[model samples]
Target: MREWINLPELGMIGLRAKIDTGASTSCLHASDIQPFQRDGEDWVRFTAHLGTLVQRRHRCEAPLVTVKNIKSSTGHVQSRYVIRTDMTLGDRMWPVEFTLTCRKTMRYRVLLGSKALVTGQLVVNPALTYVQDKPVLLDISGAP
Candidate 1:
């Protein structure tokens, strides 16, 4: 898998993602985050920024897995909401946990960390971008 990723479940495709081996967990940029209880389960509502050029926006909701204090690249620690979802890169698809926070100032909205890399499944070429063919945007009008 290349650095970029496709999150079909989240209505995101061909999205540029930063591969950070030093980080233990992945994270996604989200805005207007709101938490609520749904059917006795913790749920969160947020919006994801998709694509680079076109910059599409999608509203998403997921069950909150946990709250974690993540150290940012600048070494600042902040609490974020973690949610599990499937991420597709190349021909592989797997469940990954993504901490949700406002990353509006970051270069890329998605960050793929060590946990999502798995064991011996991916090789990162720091000098490369979009090693795999970009994914076509799927109709996620029905997605939740």
Candidate 2:
């Protein structure tokens, strides 16, 4: 299922997503990823590129969740940085963990994997696209 989602905590909205039931973990497209410490806790900062034709870039920072080795569909395994953040789909909101990686070649910047679906109790119709309304962007001062 393809849908629009929101990362309110990240101040991102109306991001297109591929809700992949085959994927075990969700992922976000990111670049210039840098790890740093904040108040003695691990954190990560990166640039999240949005849109396909008219691209928009947003700088985001989140607390480090963990590093995990994920096997891609192309049979490549890589250690990726993970972060937990609130994701909004439809009218539901919940915390979802996402692996940050370079997905410039992908059609979607957000990949909603099986874990998110199960947690969100989402049932994909496969034939459906944009089943949920385009999420409203938060009126945040620094939102892009």
Candidate 3:
């Protein structure tokens, strides 16, 4: 069932995401991406503009997994930062890998790709948008 996703770890709640099976990995819209080392572990700092109104900006940091060369729909190749974070859809919540890049031009801020939409986990109805109950917005004041 295609459903809305909540990126609690990224301080983004109830964000509409397209469940695209054609895509290999999940993607998140991020900006001001900066890489840094924290006690020998790789980390990245980024900002996410939530909602279409851009009412709130969530400043977040996550351990960097790797940089991947991802070819976009327009056939442009770009390197993106990969980060692991938790996603909640329906009654289940699990960790998912997301490639961080600026998707300002895309319709949705988040894309739930095939990698995160495992078999038996969900079934997408191409005609539907947000099949699940909307989640409450969390306190993101301390996101940074």
Give the number of the best model, judged by lDDT. 2
Candidate that scores best on TM-score:
2
C-alpha TM-scores of all predictions: 0.86, 0.94, 0.87
Quote the positional error of residue 144 for candidate 1 in Å.
22
The list of candidate 1 runs beyond 4 A from truth reads 138-144
Lowest lDDT sum, 10 consecutive residues, model 3, at 135-144
Please provide, for model 2 over 1-144, each residue's C-alpha lDDT reduced to its tens digit, 9 standing for 90 to 100. 799899989989889999899999999999999999999999999999999888999999999999999998899999999999999999899999999999999888899999999999988898879988887654558463
Q: Give stretches of model 2 more than 4 Å off.
A: 138-144
Q: What's the TM for model 2? A: 0.94
Candidate 2: worst-modelled 10 consecutive residues by lDDT:
135-144
Quote model 3's TM-score. 0.87
